[model samples]
Target: MEVHAHSHTERKKWTHYLWEFLMLFLAVFCGYLAEYQLEHKIERDREKQFIRSLLNDVSTDTVKLNNLINVRNQRENWLDSLTYVMNSQNPRSFPPADVYYYAIFIPRSIPLRFIPNDGTIQQLKSAGGLRLISIIGYDIGVRNLTRIGEVEETLINDYRGIAHYFFDGIVFDSMLDANNIPRRPKYAPQLYSFSDQNLHELNYKLFSIKAYNRASRRESKRLLQQAENLLTILKKEYHLK
Candidate 1:
């Protein structure tokens, strides 16, 4: 039998295997770091985009709040004027048509012009993104604004309750004649005629209505200032337009 010469095969060293393992581990670790950084970047960009959108909502709220404030102020003034007329020694001196025009203006409640532009805010809050707003005091500021709005809403609803519960419906029914009410600009039309006793009753109701309006007007003005302050902080903190 011919003995075949064994081919010399060198055994690989354990250190060489260990070196290959180390290289593989390092590559994986670096890839992980790169992926993590990419994800972090994406999250930051998304956060900024959401903040910008939220800023627009706040701006809209600011406009609405201002307009509501103006309406409340004007209505309060009209209520004051009506109070003077009703309490006058000679209620007969003032033309009844003029009284009707002003009295008819007493709204049951100021139309809800206050629309909180909270869509983006609600979305961010629902998604747990409010935590991402890093501006110092921003979160606190937003919370305060919401609280102010709550108080304003509560006061408005309270006044509505007072009006409905305390007021006689006869005045509103007599004042509004839809067909004849809006006949012309600056035109004073005849309203449902009031007897002397009816005038006495209406005079009392008008006083109560004026009192309720004054309370609501005060609340509205306070809310307006708070809203303006919040907007100022938002602009300063976010550098928004």
Candidate 2:
């Protein structure tokens, strides 16, 4: 009877030890799995951050490249203007040779397709003459009147149009006052007329000087400076010269 009781005690101890071993093994396995999952998550987050940083760097570089191109283009245009003036019959009429300052206002709704061809731009550039060609506030007909609200949209559309027409830029010259309106009003009849008369490739700027009713010299200068600042920013930001 003593021997049987000892055997039974030993069996119970062995069974308990086996169960404890299995529980410890399972706990270790679970810990390993949890650690592996956490590592994978951290790795993914790191990759995402790396990709985002790369994209931002690429964007910044693109902007810088564009600015550099614009500055170069502006310098070239200035040189060309000077050359044109030197060869012109009357340099006084071509103020662009010396004066690089002007304010050009583009309308807000005209599509870029309406801009004349590159010949027009080239002619203007060669002439060293600047003018504003407005696409808004002109009476195309008795029923059609150009509207002005969102200037940027009109500008982009006009840009596209000018590009399509092979024009390097636009000119804003829409009549704003009732007195300035002609009897047979048209949208930039002068530009359209020029476009029709001369089929030349032109690459020049869209130019304008805002006509104010009672603008003082200081006010006019301030406005002109503001336009120049905007042009500089556009050149730097978007590489537009």
- Best lDDT among the predictions, by candidate number: 1
For model 2, residues 1-241, the per-residue Cα lDDT tens digits are: 4555444433567878899999999999999999999999997665445334433433343343344334334434543553354335553454431322211212222221122112332343455532322111111110111121123244434434543332113322232345432122232222122252122222232321111101122232333343344334434543333
lDDT of 1 by residue, 5-108 (tens): 99989999999999999999999999999999999999877876877876677667667667766766776776677668756776556666666555555643
Q: Please give the TM-score that candidate 2 achieves against the real structure.
A: 0.28
TM-score of each: 0.64, 0.28
In candidate 1, residue 42 scores what lDDT? 95
Clashes of 2: 24
What lDDT does the true structure give each of the candidates? 0.59, 0.34
RMSD of 1: 5.8
Model 1 stretches with alpha carbons more than 4 Å out:
1-9, 108-112, 132-241
